[model samples]
Target: MGESLSQRLQHPRRSLGDRHRSQAEKFLRLSNQGEGEFSVNIQWAEQNARQALLHDFTHPENWRMLAKIKVLLADDIGIRALLSDLFAVLGRDPEYVSQLEDVSLLDVGSELLNAALQNDHLDSDIWIQSFDASDVDSFVERFLKLDLSDPRCNVLFGRRLERLWDIAGSDVCIHLGKVLLSHRPQNYEMWTNLGRAHERMGDYDQAWLCYDQAQSYAGHLTVRDDFKERMESHFDGNSSVAWSRPEISVRKDFLVTMEKLSTRFSDSVIDTGASNEEVHVDQSGDERRLENMLKNGDFSSAFFLSRRLVTSGEMWAKEYLEASKLALEGKDDVIIP
Candidate 1:
């Protein structure tokens, strides 16, 4: 079996990161010494710096080293993107965002990073790195206290969860993905990524649903069709067996379960003890809520509520669900769900 989540969380491979950082610094020094081709040494340095980050993203030094290398290579855009990623990891503080206004990242990337590090060093990635399993409740408490409403922050968390999936399991990835999607349902790429995670975990039914959502959001995308093809390929040459989408009821159940799991960690969810299914409102109120979600371009939430109402035998909800699907497909003039 793979290492447990607690064990992996407790050890962020700092030693490996240090080793790679050392190697990167050595290569950088060699490049300056002119012992060999400067480009070759810089290439080696870049490789090691990247490995260092892959091993331990929490280390601010690792990020700085990579940013320095990008500067040496005159990759201004790369440096900017790196800084953006760091800001995302830092929860996209307004101050940090403002510091970049009318500024050239190529010249001030390092200084900006330093300022960010000084302003607030309480990075969730760093917390994950230094996590102590002795107090599991404390760890959970700290995690729950994070602001998860930021899309970039959620993306950063989703990427970290993906990297740790082998040790932490696919459920974590699924939960994080749902949380991110709930905030930005228009991110079809993330939907595809979530589908891939589900596919890896053998949750084909859930995978199909995710892919379906992705395709619905981007009509030209073929991820859902590609998934179906892959499924069919597995049963080729078998006349009796075939792959198919789950029944509407099964899909609805899965969505509800996923929504509950996501809301468990999401700060946006209401504090009420009632689950979505348990929250009973008059039919008019439900319709108004659905309409408001559609007006706000919250297609994912609108889709879920419409589907739930349709499953409960509300014919009006069928129209809303179809409208939601159309809006998700990029139809601008569709009625609000």
Candidate 2:
């Protein structure tokens, strides 16, 4: 019985190898541009590669385990997996807004973009520079997912396209422009997009580097004044150059008064988890001593105080901004929960 079982239990290791090669050839044939089966090739490649997985691919939770196995066999194969997936994706819009949480798309895209840049393949796409296409304008206006917001996607996309800050899409150019004004805020080209991104973000100070830097580059008096005037109008226009969050000043004032009122009515405003008594904050700064007066609840004082804080914030926007930033950095108690 043992001898019979051994003959019946023969493993097809060599047969599997032959099958793998055949599948690989089929994958190449199916990847033709005209045939439009690249996505199919990708899927087949992934399946074939997974057949070589150390763990049972049939198990539901073994994808991560399979990846670990792939990485062991070859780091480049893992990278190819990333690029293949990116090329197959990143370009096409997915109906589902969800992303692969197991593989952070941002990190994956950044790695792929760096590889592309190292290979000197940055300027392959030119749609990044054309500001004239009315037909291909951003019809994808409404953001279905918060993560897929233009600002966030632009950053991830730009990083992936090498210096694509400038191409495959206008939104990319606009986003990279904004990234320029953050820490590396000196890259003139980035600042240009930063200006556009700021416009989209609703910040007027988000002027393009060309407008801002034109002053230095001006060789003639008339040209310098023309550029400067244009820059001024650009900032003064609908550019949404928010220094921070919306209603930021009011938010600050609301927070400050909240702490003061919280101390005044310590029993009510504290969120001890056990207590259910509620509180509110008003940033409008239009309330008075009567408004601050609380009764069976601290909510009134909290609301009025918050209102005063926010309203008062507008009067001292810049000052409040500095103080708010310092508080953020120093962990000041003036900060409201």
Give the TM-score of each candidate.
Answer: 0.50, 0.24
* TM-score of decoy 1: 0.50
The C-alpha local distance difference test score for the whole of candidate 1 amounts to: 0.66
The per-model lDDT (C-alpha) reads: 0.66, 0.35
RMSD (Å) of each candidate, 1 decimal: 12.0, 21.0
How would you encode candidate 1's per-residue C-alpha lDDT over 80-167 as one tens digit per residue? 7777767655666445645676877778887887777665453545545644435444433444555544433444455554544455
lDDT of 2 by residue, 188-276 (tens): 23334444555555443333223343222122214334434655675575677613323444334333433453343223443212222
Candidate 2 has an lDDT of 0.35
Give the least accurate 10-residue stretch of model 1, judged by summed lDDT.
328-337
Report RMSD for candidate 2. Answer: 21.0
